[model samples]
Structure formats: C-alpha cells, structure tokens
Target: MISAVFWDFGGVFTGSPFHLDDYARSLGTTNERLLEHVFGRYEANGDHPWHRLERGEGTLAEALEAADESCRADGIEGFSAEGFFKAMSGTSSEERRDKVMAKVSELNDAAIRQAIITNNAKEFGDIWRSLIPVDELFEAVIDSSAVGIRKPDSAIYRLALERLEVSRPETSVFLDDFEPNVAAARNLGMHGILVGEDIVPALRELDRILGNDGV
Candidate 1:
C-alpha cells in the first residue's frame, strides 16, 4: 500500500512562473544563447550557479554576478538576473490547479501523507509559499535551500522520507516534472511518476497505484 505521495513544486503544483524561452525572447536573445551564457547548458547539475543558489551555498546577488561574468565571457553582455526574474515573477500569478489540490485532499482524507520537495532558490521562499495553502495542503514542505540539498540528490529524498517517518521506500510514490529527480527517487526504491504538461494522467496513475480507480 502506498502511504505517502511526494510532489514537486514549480511545475507540478503551479505553472512554471518563468518560461526560459519567453524570457529570453523578451531580452532579444534566444533560449539557447541565454542558457549557454547563464547556466552553461539546459540541464545543469550540482556545479551550476543556480544549483549553488538552490543549495543555499551562495546568495542570489553572488549567483547573478557569476552569471553576468559567464555571459560576458561568452561575449554576450547585458545579462541581468534581477530584470529577468522580476519580469518572470510578474508574469506569474498564484493560479493553483484545483484538480491536483483535490487529489491531494483526497489522499490526505484517506490517511495518506503528502509532502512537497522542491529545488528552489532561498530568496523565493515567500513568493512560492504564497502560491499555495502549503500548511493545509501538505504535511511537509522541503525546500532545497532550507535543507542544503537539492533534487536528483538521493540524500534529500532520504531526508524527506525520514522526516515523514516512512521507512519503506516502496510504499511511497514520488512525482516530479524533471526526469532526473524521478529517476533518483526510483533509484532509492520509490515508485516514480513523471508529471508532464498535463497532470491529470499522472494523478490518475498515482491513484491507480494507490488502488483507487475512482479517485
């Protein structure tokens, strides 16, 4: 029996506040160029400045300075994290998905625990938390910045499980928009669900795993 369900925050609970391509276009640059200049690639791991910020090893100002330097080194000047994040955040509104929250409520009503594990920057905690009724919706909210560990790292998952008091990984279901994070959970013996643009099917799969076809 599945006793717990873990969720990802940015894409799963809410629409991605920042669309990289859109933001890049607004800045008169291509997503490829922006990513190359800022993050060095589309999917960066622990070594990236973004990851460092998420892991609480550095401040946003420092990360932005590093990004600016990287952009300058690539011969692409005028990179501003402040302007980008501000515009992106402005475009983002607190539009919670009712269906997903309803499913979470159903699971909670069934005595199944639900938690949130997200790779988020330390500075955005208040903004992100305001997007959802986090205290009522989840038993635990594990932000990477607060814990000093980000997703795709098994240690964070283990910490979440430990905090939830779930000993058997098999009895838990993990959902994330990122494949790497899902894979990491599976590696630790938990069932992993990949949430795509449409979350209904993923929720259905989770419901089926919980043996509730009607849910």
Candidate 2:
C-alpha cells in the first residue's frame, strides 16, 4: 500500500556529502576530526554553523569561517570549506549511484511516485543538481535551504508529504543515511530505511517494502 518513496540525495544517491578521508588526510587529520569540526553533532539539528547553513540562516562563507575558527581554537587549523568541497565535488558525477538509480527507475515505471528531500546548503544546489538528473528522476526535489526547514524537524517532512498529496504518511517510505532523520520519519508514522556505507541492504529493504504492488 505504499503510495510514494522519499529519498535523501547525499548519502543515499551519491557519495557522502564530501570526500572525508581524502580531505582529512590533506589536512593531516583524521576523518572523524574533520567531520566533527566541520559538521558538528549532525545527528541533532542544533545551533552549529553547518546546521545553520543548511537551514538557510547563514552563507557558506560564514559557515566555513566558523569551521576555521573552531579549528584554530583547538590549535588545529587549515580547514577550508571551499577547498574541501571543491575537491570532493570533483569526484561527483552521474552514474555514481547506478543501483539506486535503477531502483528509482523501477519505481517510476511502476507509477510509484518519488521525491528527494535533502538537508543541503543553498550554495550547493547547482553543483549537486547537475550531478543528478533531478528533474527527470524525481517529481519533487525538496532542499532544506530553499524551504528554510531542515531534517529531523517534522515540519519539513510534513511539507514534503503535503506536496506529494499523501493522505497517509504511513503509506510512504523514506530513506536516509542519518539515523536521526530516519527515526524522525518513523516517529511520524512513515516507513524509514537507514542507509549505511553499503547501499544494497537499504535498497533491498525498500524493495521489500514496495514489493510488486506498484502502488
């Protein structure tokens, strides 16, 4: 009885938001340190600089400055968002997510509607959009920056379902790499899949949920 499928763009369809390991190595740091300094407690939608950026409250430049400040405070410096994102984006392109793309095709063919809900910065829109055939692959693309509402905040989830005109939230499935986001969706009564480093298991779970009923 699933009516639609909701996807997260970053981890679900493409590589992680950035090239963590490479970027970290370039800075003579560990991936964990880089993520902590840059992203800062991502599981929660807090007052962190990156969180504020995704919520459209600040510019990418401001967020990077915050990262640099935090690094300098800890006596660890030389973290530049511009440089890191540039290097990371260099590796991004279409076909990076063929498995998910195929499943999306199958769902599209079955007439099961799909949309993308991403916690993203406004500045990243053009870069990421070009990496995916968003218009062709999804009926709706929801970005937190554009909408002024980020994930783990039920308002955005409600907004997406509203746009999709879904009467029963439980009849939709949402997939994301972040557990908190997925958990929030489940709390709102949707079937949620937590995508991990391995994409196949998550896709398998989606297949099991949708079955062959074709909506």
Candidate 3:
C-alpha cells in the first residue's frame, strides 16, 4: 500500500502552460538549438541554468549573468536575460486544475497520505498559504527554492520521505510533470508517475495504481 503520495506543483496540480516553441521564438533561436543549449546532456548535473531559476533560488539578474557568461563562452553575443524572463513570465498559470490543498484534502479523506514536492519560489508559497492552509494539506512540502536545491536531486527526495516518516520506497509514490524528474524518483526506488499530458489522466492513473495496491 502506498503510505505517502507526492505531487508536483506545476502541471500536476496547476495548469502551467510553458511552451518551448514560444520561448525559442521569443529568443529568436530555433527550438532544437535552444534545447541543446539549455538542456544539454549535462542537465542531470543541475547544469541547466533556466531550470534552476524556475526553482526560485537565484534572482533573474543572477540567471542573466550566468546566461551572459555562457553566451560569451560559446562565442555568441547579445543574449538578453530581460528578454528571456519576459517570455518566461508570459507563460501564465493553468486555470483548469483544482488547487493542491483541495486535492490533498480529498486524498486525506480517502485515508491516503499526501504531500507536495515542487520547484516553486518560496515567496509564492507564502502567498499560497494566504489562500489556503498549505501546511494542513500535505504531511510535508519540499520546495527546492526554499531549500537551495532542485529536483532530479536525490537529497530532496530523501528529505521528503524522511519528513513523511516513510522509510521504504514501496510505501510512497511521486507524481511529477517532467519525465526526468519522475526518473529521479524512480532511480531512488520510489514509484513515479510522469504527468506530461492532462493531469486528470495522471490523477486517475494514480487512483488505479494505489487502489490496486490497497492504499
């Protein structure tokens, strides 16, 4: 039985429509090249600068400096961090899904343990609780920005499990919007659900998987 259920904040619970094509167009770069530049094979090592920015540790200025350094290193010039952030800020949050607190309450009522492991800003979380009792929703919430860490990092996952008091990976399940993030949890021997498509399907899939396990 799954004793603890972990969910990602964006895409999984919220409707964050971040598009790569739009970002590339905004940057005047081809999608393929942008992907190679930002998410090269070294992404697993937390080398993808933008991914870290989304987690909220560094300010936009800091990220821009990093990008400038990277651009100079690649012998490319005129990469504007302002332009990149403008495109990023343009991708609005999704309106279709329910807030995480409501969903967690639903799962808790079903007697399943629930928590949130997301790469969001600490400031946003503070504002989020003003809308709902965030602490009451999940047994734990592991925010990468607040912790100075990001997903695909095993240490953060371990922190979540330890906080939830779940020792075995079999007792927990993690759902994330990104495949690589899901893969990280899987590597840790935890059950993982990739939520790249509609989250309703993923939520239903979770129900089926956990239901079969008698959670």
Highest TM-score, which number?
A: 2
lDDT of 3: 0.68
Best by lDDT: 2
Off by over 4 Å in 3: 16-18, 35-42, 46-58, 68-94, 99-102, 121-133
RMSD of 3: 3.8
Ranking by TM-score: 2, 1, 3
Q: What tens digits encode model 1's per-residue C-alpha lDDT throughout 143-162?
A: 98999998888999999999
Q: If both were scored by lDDT, which would come out higher, candidate 1 or candidate 3?
A: 1
TM-score of each: 0.84, 0.89, 0.75
- Candidate 2: list runs displaced more than 4 Å: 25-28, 90-95, 212-215
For model 1, state the Cα shift of residue 197 in Å. 2.3
2 or 3, which is superior by TM-score? 2
Candidate lDDT scores, in order, read: 0.79, 0.85, 0.68
Deviation from native of the Cα of residue 105 in model 3, angstroms: 2.4
Instruction: For candidate 1, give the lDDT of residue 86.
Output: 63
Residue range with the least summed lDDT across 10 consecutive positions in model 3 = 91-100
- Residue pairs whose backbone atoms clash in candidate 2: none
